[model samples]
Target: MRRLPIRPFAVLATVGTLVLTGCGTETGDPGDRPSSAGADRTIRAHKVMQLTQTHEETGMTLLEGPVFDEDGRLLVVDVTAPEGKPKVMRVNVSDKTFRAVRTQGQAAYTSAQFSPYDGRLYLTDFAHGEIVSLAPDGSDPRTFFSGEIDGARMNPDDLAFDRKGNLYVSDSRGLREGEARGRVVRIGRDGRTVTVLAKNLAAPNGISFDEDYQGLWFSELTENRVSYLRLDGEGRVTSSHTAIRVDGGIAQTDSIAVDANGNLYQGLHGRPAMAVFNRNGERLATVELRGRTEGLESATNVAITPGGTKAYMTVSGPGGGFLYTFDALAKGIRQSNGG
Candidate 1:
């Protein structure tokens, strides 16, 4: 991920206060009643793999983009790891073991997903402003999308693919309030033509196609909200609107996934939780960490298995990075794989 600029002094002061005093409280708009507000069902997630060293000595590690390959192996990215450290890892959930898959580059890979057309793994290299792809075994890395569009650089954060193999990316460039320089772009299946589907967004980060692929959903980090874009037969946006507004407290929204039933599992920072919402924006439930949140404040991304019976979340903070699992609310499909 691109380094975030420091906020204004007043906003920093307020965020500091919230961090100190609201550690145990649930975060959401008071006007919106979350199911967690009334004995809502809570899924306890346990750690499956540890991805980092102690932050005091090695700095913080950020884990994002939990995805599963056709072989059922889980893959994730370590965005904060420097050169020579593992940037991509493969984990076997059955035995709770993991191994470094690729570590030869200096790329800050923020998200990973398998292409339906090629079956290769594609990653969003946020630090390089490009999308790179490699074979399932982590070999033959090559640039898939790079350079600029309309004379502007792109900070590609996350991506999703359609049934026809077309790719959509979220260009999370501007982080400042009221700076709507962010956008969403699409790459045709031919791998040459690039189109800007939406622009003037506020740090559009997580992106995924909704059920039936008739629309798209993306999270605007700067605005702390999710927006939906109805797409035409040619994947052009016909209409768009804000679907959900989140009260992030001291944090912001991050990566997201969609279930077969069209429920959105949105990851959150500054807390170990995920807020679930139906396609219509109704609060369904808030999936919270099962244990201590002392150093696990960052729950940035989630991936559900094919059957949707189980889900995994990638979390990180000063305590390092970890993978947590919980029961999913609905059946999982291709859309729930990753973003």
Candidate 2:
């Protein structure tokens, strides 16, 4: 998914300023703004499992899309794995064991989540621009959504489903092209109606419904900010605005999750950390890796348990692919499950 070179932290500071001023309408009053000077609390995450080790020829492992299943097992995808290798795996966090979930074809899977309606596992194939599904045990592979929509090719990065079983996806084309070619699409439970909810976004990567399901929160990677779209009863975008403007330094916003309290857990790329933000776009705390971050730099996606007891992040780089665990800030409901 990261086809572009990593930008320096200095460069990002300039970019962040431009994005904050030009992106969208800002919510919350200036007087209510929480100080961005630093996080109130800092939590250290420990490694729970290492999926891959450092390799020379094969390159650094890039892991993404950490989601929990109904049985409480963690599911993740390795976007850099070659063909014949296990692209998806089920990790039993209790014992630190894992099982490979067979996926057909050479698609580079980026995200995974179990549908609350059908109880099937769905994944976004970043390489093929397709959304595929399978059983919990990783059987019955089938394509759910694919190809172009309204003449635009999809570069699906992350996805989430609503309580009504409607699926939403972030088509991340802008990050690679450096333009506003990104889009957010919604598919009805019938699996036939595909609706384009929002367009002209700057590489929208992560997506999740708000606590009340009245709107959606998505991250724009190129813009270095997170935006929200107020939705109608029909799941159409009524209005939208920028919620959080992040100074990622060397990192860019990737996947995100919303807790029961409507707090957003925004994952970062090129930095081993997850930035927590409240509904008013205030910084709460930052969860970071405990030890050296020499090679493990990509902390792209995170998922919290149903009751918000624990949270896990998928990190990968030259060091290898690993899952890091920490405590959750709020109760993790359906909105924080996959995205």
What is the alpha-carbon RMSD of candidate 2 to the true structure? 7.6
lDDT of 2 by residue, 217-314 (tens): 99988788999999998899999998889987767888888888888888877677777788898787777777666666677777889985577778
Q: Which runs in model 1 stand beyond 4 Å of their true positions?
A: 1-41, 54-58, 176-178
State, as a TM-score between 0 and 1, how close model 2 is to the true structure: 0.87
| Candidate 2 weakest lDDT stretch, 10 residues | 18-27
**How much is 54 displaced in model 1, in angstroms?**
4.6
Error of 1 at 166 (Å): 0.8
Candidate 2 ranges with C-alpha deviation above 4 Å: 1-39, 54-58
Error of 1 at 196 (Å): 0.9
lDDT assessment of candidate 1 = 0.74
Task: Evaluate residue 7 in candidate 2 and report its C-alpha lDDT on the 0 to 100 scale.
Answer: 26
When summed lDDT is taken over every stretch of 10 residues in candidate 1, the lowest stretch is: 15-24
Candidate 2 yields a Cα-based lDDT of: 0.73
lDDT by residue for model 1 (1-339), tens = 322221210011121121100011122222233444233344566666776763231245677778899988889887756667778899888888888888876676778999999988999877667888999999999899888888886778889999988999988766433478889999986678999989988878879999899999998876789999999988899999988997767666777789988888887655677777888787677777765666666777788899856888887766667887777778777788877
Clashes of each: 0, 0
